[model samples]
Target chain A: MATFSFAVMAVLPLFLMIFIGYFLRVFHVFKESFFNEVTRFCFKVAMPCLIFKNIYSSNLDVGSYVPLVVFGITGIISLAVIGCLFIPLTVKDQKKKGVMVQNLFRANFFFFGIPMITNIFGEEHIGPAVMMVAFVVPIFNILGAVVLAFFQEHEGKKRVDFKDILHNIFTNPIIIGAIIAFLFVLLKIPLFDFVVDVIGDIADVTTTIALISLGGTFKFQSAKHNMPYIIRGVLDKLFLVPAIMLTIAVILGFRGPELAICLALFGAPGAVASFVMAKEAGADGELAGQLIVFTTAFAFVSLVFFIFILRSLGFI
Target chain B: MASSFSFAFGAVLPIFMLVGLGYILRRLGYFPEAFVTLINKFCFEVALPALVFYNIYTSNTTIGQNSGLLIFGALAICGIAAVSLLILPKLVKESPRRAVLAQNMFRSNFILFGIPMAANMYGNDGVGPASILLAISAILYNILGTAIMAYYQEKQRSGKKSVHIVPLLKSIFKNHIIIGAALALVLLSLQIQLPNFLDRTVSDVAKVATPMGLMAVGAHFNFARAKADFRYLMIGLSGKLLIAPAIVMIIAIFCGFRGPLLGALLGMTASPGSITSYVVATSMDADGDLAGELVVFGTALSAFTMFGFIFLLRSLGFL
Candidate 1:
């Protein structure tokens, strides 16, 4: 019962906070353009800091998890296969195929996954979770992009430039964060902690403002047109994918913090990456928006149900 | 519960404050163009790199039994993502926009969102491995991901493709962030530490980067444009935020990733489309608007898709 209440308390406030920002925007308590700016902040500043701090501070064994690494790479390969199988059955647009390939593996581990995992498992479980997120996400990005480009080439279209991939992966802020941190760890070089501490000190404002700003962008009316896509998206993301992940985790004997964090991560709502991908592919941005709204709305219930089941089974 | 509240509050409050304030200032017309440029440059060139460098300089390494696992684990994830791009297209009829959509669905936001969140969750321990994986991903993205994009464009034009090694090497060297990262690594390897004054200055500058960047983000909404390009965006969003992560998870399980590694792998699986994707799209002239929409849509949808993924992982005791 205590755990149940704890679960509610953990999730409710987060939802409430975002909703409050949303209502404040709706009521005109704040100016309308706030969300756009906040979203910008999240992209430009806060998130980068978050990545830097995480990568730098952790003490990790980059070589300990061969099995896990192999597993992750194989997982991406499977995503392509799954996407290929479905492509023929349902959709046909080449760009949409590219989009499908990307979304099949893009997970949100930062805000949603971290909080939920920390909430349920405490701080101890954070390290491995972070490692998995850092390593797997980027590989997913690069490989996913490559696969998309390959399909484009097969159609006799202009392919994604190999140079672009290299430039993007290596020079990217997050990837840089991962690399630099790893080197620092490997070399045993110690810097004055104040450097990051100062940044860390100011970090909280970035995400909060972004969330509030996102709230300001909320337009209930906008959701009307993209309902079908949103529904389908929710079905695929909030239901089917997670169900599949759970079956796999159970069969594989994952337990404790690993299980908890994985579940929390699986339950995370669609990331803003969907919108980015849609815009890049010249797909329906509105559909992406609808997915965000719809999935976020449903995630509350799904997460709660997840917690209940986990606690009942003594998993948490 | 209290701890969780405090943790969340700690994470979000500052963002709320800065963005909220920035919005007010923007509406007041207090932010000049020069100011915006300065802010962007500071965030991008100096502060951002410092943040990355500082973090890297502080981490601890794990190299024994864990080494093989990290390498193989990353390889597996990369392999899967590549395979997805291939397979997804086969399931659907090929079309002109397939390249863009496939890229959207397959790619992820590693640095912007994933790193920080990983930091907050795992601290230094997870950050170390995450960084290594990130490097591997970087190599893969540049070599494999970009190759695919280029191939598509070539095929669409003349159906003729050839490897252009010189251009690729030039581009690789020219990437600012990568260069910065490489420099930092070299410095770390050389055991060079910044002087206190320099360190303090860089750190101070870095400190301002996040809040300022966040403010800039707040001012960057394009609902009007997004609304104009709804359909194509939705397709991209669906592929990226939904299908992409689903496929990754299945593969991860089949490949036997479990425990914290599995959780982290899954965590990475659901990231939204990266801004880097936008950069690549623009450079290649493939569909920038579509890329932007994917970033937007992928980000928004992640809230729910992530939750569902978490729920499933929890039920299966893999959290």
Candidate 2:
């Protein structure tokens, strides 16, 4: 019961924020363009600052968490490989296969995962979770870009811009933030208190703004039309992936907060980036959008269940 | 004295640096024109509101405590508006230009510049009064600006004159700054403490508003257009940053307003012409170019004028 309440407490504010975004959109308080721009700002500016601050402040020892790091990387890569192989076989449409595959593997680690971990473990003990982000986010981006590029609509007419892909992956704001933060931590550089305060301020609103924008941009009409694909995508993301990943981690002797972090990494909603990548890459943007909405809507139940089970088993 | 000068300089320099960086980044194509607009929108909608809300909500001071400062701020704004309305018409002949000039002279960029400056001077204690003053001043400027524009516009169109109260009220209510302040005040009154996560999230996002706002101000600075309307521009700047503030400060000091209250007033009175005045002018078919020039010049000159105010205030031991 305690774990259940904790999960509810953790997820409630996030949903409320999304609802506010939706209300604002419906009431014409915020225009669609405003939501888009704010989301981009959150992703590019605020999220990076947050990741950097979290990792930089953490007393992370890379050498100590080698097993967990190895497990996380292996889990994501295998999930991507499995998604790539299975999605194409099931989905007849070429454009949709890539998006589905991408959705299957890429969790909302940046938005949902980090905040969830912080909630469950508290801020001081989230070093391993931040480390997971540092490893998972870049890999997710690279794989997402590659998958989108592979199944781009005009594949025969236009060659894929490898430079753009590499640039996007390398210059990704979250990745850059993680790298800079790692350097700061590794080199033992002391940041000014005011600077840290300012960064902390910027980082604080990232999740709230992102969640609101997610709600604002949500298309219920699209979900209605793409119900089957959305359900499949949600099941794959919210259930199958976490189930496999957490079991693997538990079997590998991972326990407590480590397992909790794994659950967050794997069990959260499909990333909003999937929709962005789909639209940009000319894949099935509608399906991707629906996937995000459904997964997000159902994520609370899944998160609560995971926490309850983990707590009951004394694994977290 | 030297230490005070350094302290004042340290408080003000980061703001200028961010603005300068914004100008350079925009010039170098690092931030596209669309991106600049987007950043401004985000600041106004999300960041600035959050900052105001958080500042006011977290403040231990009550509205009753700062009622004097609030009343003084309202009176000062009204005084400036009245003076500008009476004097600006004689200086600028065209009715639209007169209205825009009058509005620009009285309406300072209080939110972007004032709160931060006050906070710098008095730390956390300053923010409470500054934010309250911001809420009051924002409403005053909007209503006064609309009335002036409407009066002139009516004269130009059909010679029937009355402020469009409905639309004006709609705008005032819809304003994110006003909404933020109002919501924060409500929360404060209710004794509601936001959850730890929510509070941290808001502050983080709210922190972006100052730097982003100053940078947007810098990025939007127009050199070419500013030179075109030098005569009217000078009038607007002097009225906004120098004459208006000086009069207000003397009165405030005489009224026993000292410390953060005085600092807050100085910060508000000494700010530049609001960027909103330019938007209002352009949309209302007034001398938007002149309004734009006033904003650019008024803002450019304000950095020095504001520093001088801070210096003088500190020297007098008021801050």
Candidate 3:
């Protein structure tokens, strides 16, 4: 009972934040322009600073990261492979098929992962979780680019070349944030105290802003026309991936923070960035957006159940 | 005083760094021009109020314990405005610019920075005094700001457009931050509590206040504008960030203020010029260029001044 309540406590407040944002938008307190501008600020600047600062400050301790790095990479790839294999069976629209595939694989670890780790174990124990971004973000972006690039050509659009895929993955802000932090850690580069504090300030604000902005962009009307597709995407993202990856994790003897991080990396909502990537890559942006909302809207229940089950089994 | 030097350094450094980060990101073309304006609206209309309400509601310290903050803050604001009005007419020469200077001297960006700085110095629960100060000072800022600008605008324009009591009251009551603070106070007085989920929601929203508030301030900072309007900029920066706070610090210390009380008071009197100064100035037919320049440059130079004052106060054990 205690563990179950802890699970509820862990995920409830974060989702309530989104609910606050939705009601604020409904009352017209947040206008249309707010959604895009704040979202842009969060992803482009604050999110990067968050990942960068965490990895930079963390002890490199490479002996410990073997599980997270190895499992994290394979976990994402397997989910992507699973997504590629199964999405066409579930979705009909070619553009939205890519979005669903993207949804099934990509967890918004960039947005939700850090906060969830912080929520469960407190901020001090979040280093291992933050380092997960260093490995996870690149795979998510590369796969996102490739999936969307291939599906986009069905609309008679020119396929994005392999070089462009490499370029996009390398140029992604969150990936760059991770890369730079890796350099700082590996190279033992010492930042001035003031510089660290400044970035820390930016890092501190990232998750809350990302969550609220995600809420501001929440539109019920967008989901009205595509409830069936949305439900399938949410189910695949919130349940199927976790049921698969987390099982593999337990089989491999993963437990504690690593296992908790895996749960966060797999079980949370679909990536918010998937919507933007879809819109830009000529996929069904509306479906992408809907998947994000419903998955995020439903993520609380899914997370509580997963966490409670894992805790009862003593897996994490 | 665990190294007062480091204490002050920790508090002031992040603020400048945030502003500098915004300035650099903007220079590199990451922040579009529109992001600054829109985010400012987000902070004021949404984040600032939520921060104040959350801080006051969650605080165990009741209003009676910090009642002196209300009295001290009000007196200091009114005192400085009186002084500025008495001395600035002969000093500034032009009626519009004088009014702008007068307004800048009395008003700091207290609503945005008050809780954040207090929280920064003394953690989240320590912001009770600051939130109480916010509710009172927010109303005072608007009333005084409008009265000062309107009085001089009338004087300069041969009595064309001066203040009206109804409009003034309406403007104060209409402001989102003031309304938020007022709501919190009403609930506080009645000993009402928000339902658990709603209470948590406000706490979550309030967490965004400092970082976003600082980022928005940083993004709006205009470095190039500093070079053109050197004179008014000097006066506004020196007066608001240094001299006014300096005078108020003596009074506070003499009255035995210390710790987070002093930090909240510093936020009230020593922060940068309010961005709204430009809006209020131009609306009253004042010199928009000088007002804009003062605000732009005041914010830029405030980093160094904030560091100095915080460092000094820390060394003195008044923070």
Candidates' C-alpha lDDT: 0.58, 0.75, 0.75
lDDT of 1 by residue, B122-224 (tens): 5665465566555545445544445556656555555445546565555555544445556666777788887543453344444555556545444443568
Candidate 1 structure quality by residue, lDDT tens digits, A1-316: 8666756654554465467568867776555654564465565455555655665675655575554556555655675667667744664555555555455555555656655665566555565666666676667566656655555525455566778767866766556666666677778778655455545644544444454455566666656654555566676767666667755765676666666555655566766766665665455555655566667777777777677766777766
DockQ order of candidates, top first: 3, 2, 1
- Candidate 3 colliding pairs: none
Per-model TM-score on C-alpha atoms: 0.48, 0.76, 0.80
Note the residue pairs that clash in candidate 2: A201-B204, A202-B204, A204-B201
Clashes of 3: 0
- The CAPRI class of candidate 3 is acceptable
lDDT at position B171, candidate 1: 51
- Give the number of the best model, judged by TM-score: 3
The per-candidate TM-score of the B chain, in the order shown, comes to: 0.67, 0.71, 0.68
DockQ of each: 0.03, 0.23, 0.44
Q: 1 or 2, which is superior by TM-score?
A: 2
Q: Which is the better candidate, 2 or 3, if ranked by TM-score?
A: 3
Query: Residues B1-319, candidate 3, lDDT per residue (tens digit)?
Result: 3343354345456666766676777788777767766665666667666776775565554568788888998999999999989888767777888888898998877654556667767886547778777766765776687777666755664554455566556655665655776788789779998866567667666767666655555665665655655777777778887899999999999998888888888888877766566555654577655665665566656656766787788877778
- Model 2 interface Cα RMSD in Å: 4.5
Q: Please give the interface root mean square deviation for model 3, in Å.
A: 2.4
